[model samples]
Target: MIKTIKHFTISSLLYGLLFTSCDLDRLPMEGPSTGNFPANEQEAILGLNGAYQSISTLDAASTPIWHVMDNITDVGYARPGNNYTSPITSSVTTDNALATKPWQYHYRTIARVHLVLDNLSNLETSMDEGSYLQLAAELRFVRAYCYSQLIELYGNVPLLRHAVGLDNADVPRTPKAEIQQFILDEMSEIAEHLPINQSAYGHVRASRIAAYMLKARVALYAKRYAVAAEAAKKGLEYAEGIHDLTSFNATIDVAGKDHRAGEPDVSNIFGHEGYANSAEWIWVAEYSIAAGNTHNRQYYGASRLGKGVCYWGPTQNFIDSFQALDGLPIDESPLYDAQRPFENRDPRLDLYCVRPASRFMGYQFQPQTEHRTVFNYWPVNNGSSSEPSSVTNTDATNAYRSFSGYLWRKHLDLNDFNSTSVSGESELNVGIFRLAELFLIYAEAKIEANELDGSVYSAINKIRQRAHMPPLTEGLTQQQLRSALRYERKIELANDGLRWYDLRRWGIATDVMNGYLYLNRAGNGWSTNTLQYIDENHNPVYNHNEATKHFTTQTVIYKENKDEYWPIPASEMDANKQLIQNPGY
Candidate 1:
């Protein structure tokens, strides 16, 4: 019943800005009525497309919105230069721009769907029921998605089922539990009508599996473990046939000036080009040079393979979360070497970050080293085995040249063209939903339900095997499996912008991120408090011969919140007297 026609024609429209005329202040004294729009199926498709447009705001490569999700978590650190320190370690307020923007954007998306939904009742011409159901399901799916995000971010939010007029629009907040049930029910009703597969790339139309996935994720967040487990299982029924953990290695040119093979695990799974219309993609935020953050994503967090702000970096705590290839933590495994911290870690860790001496984009990035004369190890009498680097502090703000010293490597465009800056036409894409995530969902839900069957082990191991890590120990207890699930999600889904939510869903944000996050700094020829590297007692001087001042810890404290939700935008509270702010705002 889902419409095969995809894509919106109304590209000019943006977050809640309806343009009546080209003139800024001038309105036509008399304009065509709303009745004139979408008289046929072709036009209705455009209206549906317009509803889907708001999703672009969620793309990390395009906007600053994702910074909220990435920075507020324990896994990542916000660059101090952009002044994102507040989101990371300060008290978040209702006036926070990150809190307000997502509210406006999601509602704007919801409102667009309301247009199609509201007009469906007034359609003058006859339309097929199958076609009508398909259109209706698509809108409902989008609406549910927006509400789901609102529920995750704000907790209790107004569920606007249909479009509202500009005047008389004060709506009260609905309890989150009620909204959660409503979404599950609504998706169940629409599942029979949606397509089994989306007809085109970047389209918002859901297949039955997408609906199940949404339900599974929502139920998991809702803590309906049994419901989540069953829904995830059903989702896998549709997923297993169409998508697999398998990936292909293609020799693609980097901006046609350099050549590199796709990363074995994740590189091929993401990005707009090369993988377009690939079966593994369940949902994505599609964009073009016409409308995308090709420049913005490159500007921040991306590697210096292109010019970037390096506005964010991962913490040493997150880096340590990766297990050795032998399926043991660095502390447990004999492979770990304190002198060379990044070596022999999980392969994905290197793929996802620009660590001390890792290679990427034809450059050996060393963020923790001092200037050229400085090597990480003592190279003279008591020297290090590590090689030296010309590029010290590779991941840092250009203004300050200081950072947490780790850079996120996922979704970065490393071609020669964007090697220093984006052309505003970068072809990177955002993955909204993928099969690998579903596997985790199923595994996590099963663990939560205390039902660690063979399927649970199979699901979790598929992702582990792809990353080329050893399989988990078989026949583990439920508690042990839960621990395994936590690590799997952390390493597998790092920097994909989901860890923040995971911290909340697992009810461990306070325990995991509350205290000081330790960042280890080590370099040769540096002075220390213990005078190990210092030769003088009163006037401290470095030996410059020993790897002294070896490693020091920097702390960033994350406060535990009374409630898991972010504050509702202060402006919304002021505008709507009936609206209540979330706890601890």
Candidate 2:
């Protein structure tokens, strides 16, 4: 007979309140003790709320640490005056303040989750078996999530399972392979007990599907192609049961009028409303300003909009990758008349970026006047105004006034009607994992496993079809298929902060990023390599015309290295002597 621990309503309420309030640092009245043991229970639910709270707060959007990583990568370029650092593209050191901060936060969250797991394992209560299993599953999910972050950023991290006291804080680093295995094992165990359907916790909480998706992601990162494919297939099974493809109009519509009418196909997985619980999303971090927590939208909003605190522009490499509307490469497509570059390009380009002189939400986006340019195609001053305002050797005749020539388009809520509105505060759930990503994962895994002629074609074809791209020709070699897969992933996941990681994992960052930089300089009458335009008066404009030089151009070679892992913060090392720095840091 299993003895059951009585459910304490008061205790549960208190825990709920603490999590709902988003405060985990507060000291409990009973100190850190797990209280009395129960007779037959193998786990306790107490302190699990703290672990869940950590997940919600550590989201990349809301946390400055995650944003720091996003800004430093090639997917987005920081403004000239911005003080941001990224370990992926630049050499980040222990002395670098931003590089060291994320290490501390991640470790702190890990410590809390470890405490919950420790207490749960020791409990002897005959508590609700279902509840105990659910709590244990959630704890494992979060622990695996923390390790995933650590593995991606630091390469190897200490895989501490027990809650350590101050005296036992010094723990040695675990090997990267071992750490990844540990995470996979934990997620696999959790998946067995996690619920498959939506419940009281909502879509923001981890379900069995989320665990499987995470397993797939971690396996792919570790280059375990077979395991990745299996995990992705499992996740897709659940994802397919839930979401259908949203229509192109709904995906690109700023008004969201179709979405508001309860039209399922009109909502994206990332929209603020309508699709929060849609089948597309396997996991999301929920946010509401009324809850005293907000998602990170300030990074991309207009400066006139109160939250536009950071301006990380897009790169020329990204802009050039978008295929023409007819599915031909920009360089290959005859419709790609260099003079009018924006016309007839992939629809995603217009949906994902706000280019200079482009219309978004009925307002003209003039980069020179507002410093809201989309990509880094113009000259950027390094701390001083002494550098030439125009890019050297590039025609100043077609220069735009802004330093970065592109603005972020994804996740920006245009339907809010107010230019100054903070779209980040909306109740929309921020998707951490989605089905479309799973499809890409399956496609990549199959390609890597030398199964390109098998199911890989179907998976890749689905994504290409959505992008309106033609099917990849049959009989291509593995290397050719790999190239195609890489291109597909880039365009499909552009502006979603996946490019930097993908490039690093594929070991192609240097080759892809090292090249001449160019921007569409048509606005200022400067010819970007001899393209011409005309004014409303029908006057033929030369590359030197005022309209031609309005576009800006900035180009520089990027230095990259295998020292891709960020250095564990010196502060953490000082506190935990067992933590080792990654190689070449």
Candidate 3:
């Protein structure tokens, strides 16, 4: 919530109260140090903003945050240069910075929320009682949102719904089942007091849709499929009026896809100009170019543009996760031709990554060319160091950049590469939730609940139609539908910081992230194939000896129950003696 802390007058006065870690044993008889603040409407509004500021404690483009969230799952692989082997291999210790960050930021936000809620009984405002109730509901929504993530990440975390002083801070960890119910109950109960819509673009506030979104996600995580289904249905009803999926259907002339996809599908949703004022974003975090956003995601996600560290590389497993146009994996689908791997694949694969031989930002990406710059054309406006960004592993570039054979294109701003200073100033908001996500949630929840009715099919088809993929067959068993739903959710939500959470919730992280995450090939099976060249649109031509070659990559071990929950930060337990670490931590 410190993202917008300047608007709040109490920031300077309550700095320690807002940022300091809480002690849980008891509350002193004396009152809160800053109890006198938040006495008026202006102060109340500022306090609410203070509570919301922690949402951006980790930026959309932050490497550390993304490394812990995405790399540990099946969808992402971080550059090995950072030396974060603990998280990469699923053996992270309690003292890891990754463990400390969510603990600090989430609880810090919860503390702010408690401050606002505790003052709710005393504030006098010009707005009606309904308006005050709406504000109260929003504060609770923020608190519930943080708790939802906390319980999932570190099960049995202390649930501090109210302001706690040093003397009263040492509370025992609440069971996840109970914490999950609390979140569901709070969101559903407060949802009625909230309006259907709030006119804000920067994700500065919450609405009824956010309440239902949280309810659906948390309920699903708790395996309360019925509640998840109902909440998703209600959320869909509210979202239908304001947002529609972006499309890239060149064959069909639809309202949203009235033009080319590069503009609407790719640009508007993730790029600079589009994120500046996008309709697809449901809940987002705002940043200022003047004050500077936290990180340059465009630089990290890129292979040729901007800073071009390309901090991550997509695993071959993730590449294969995408279904072919025939809605099947490459091994099963008839449309999939090994000679033409990129062709006949899902458009999302092309849109979300700079795939082999694909045209990108007015140039072609040819990783097999053996040139420093993989792209046929490089933007020279930005300062250069004689060699292209492709020449990584040198003095100016990182050795692990894009070593995984693919780069992320989903959350990056394509236009932020104008210059050194401007390139690092991408203010693209991180969408906390999106309309497409709600659709998938509703579809999956309904499927799991054995209610494969017309509505379920309709909801899924809307998402599929946007991606220009084929629909589900006429009849599929519950098990079959479950399979379909699983892949759909994975592909649609990849790299948006939801993959790890989704895998853990579905109990599939152990299966998916079990082994090698393919980055780039250098020896044994890959070198011989580089000699044969093909056109950008052509499939790779392998020699007779190299035809049976298999690529080499890195390995990761997901420790089943052990890795499902992160450890409580060592410092947190030191501060509160009553706290116990999660199992196997």
Model 2 agreement with the true structure over 1-585: per-residue lDDT tens digits:
111111223433454564443222432101133234222343234455445544555544343333334445545565543235334335556766555545555665665665566666454254566777887788778778878887787787777776565455577888889989998898888897888754344465578888888899899989999999999888777767565444455544332121112111222434554343345656655554444445555434333222353355555445656667676666557777656666677666666655544543323344453333332121221344432232222111223222356656555544432323444443344557666788888878888899765677777777677655677778878887787777776666655556657767887656544433344423333334442432221112234333234444443344654455667777666667666666556
What C-alpha lDDT does candidate 1 achieve relative to the native structure?
A: 0.61
lDDT of 3: 0.64
lDDT of all predictions? 0.61, 0.56, 0.64
Instruction: Compose the digit string of candidate 1's lDDT tens values, residues 372-416.
Output: 322222122134434433434443324433255666766654542
Model 2, residue 249: distance off in Å is 2.8
Top candidate by lDDT: 3
Q: Which is the better candidate, 1 or 2, if ranked by lDDT?
A: 1
Report the C-alpha lDDT of model 3 over 70-142, residue by residue, as the tens digit: 7555567776632345665777888877666687778877777777688786764555798689878989999
* TM-score ranking from best candidate downward: 3, 1, 2
lDDT of 1 at 306: 35
- Models ranked on lDDT: 3, 1, 2
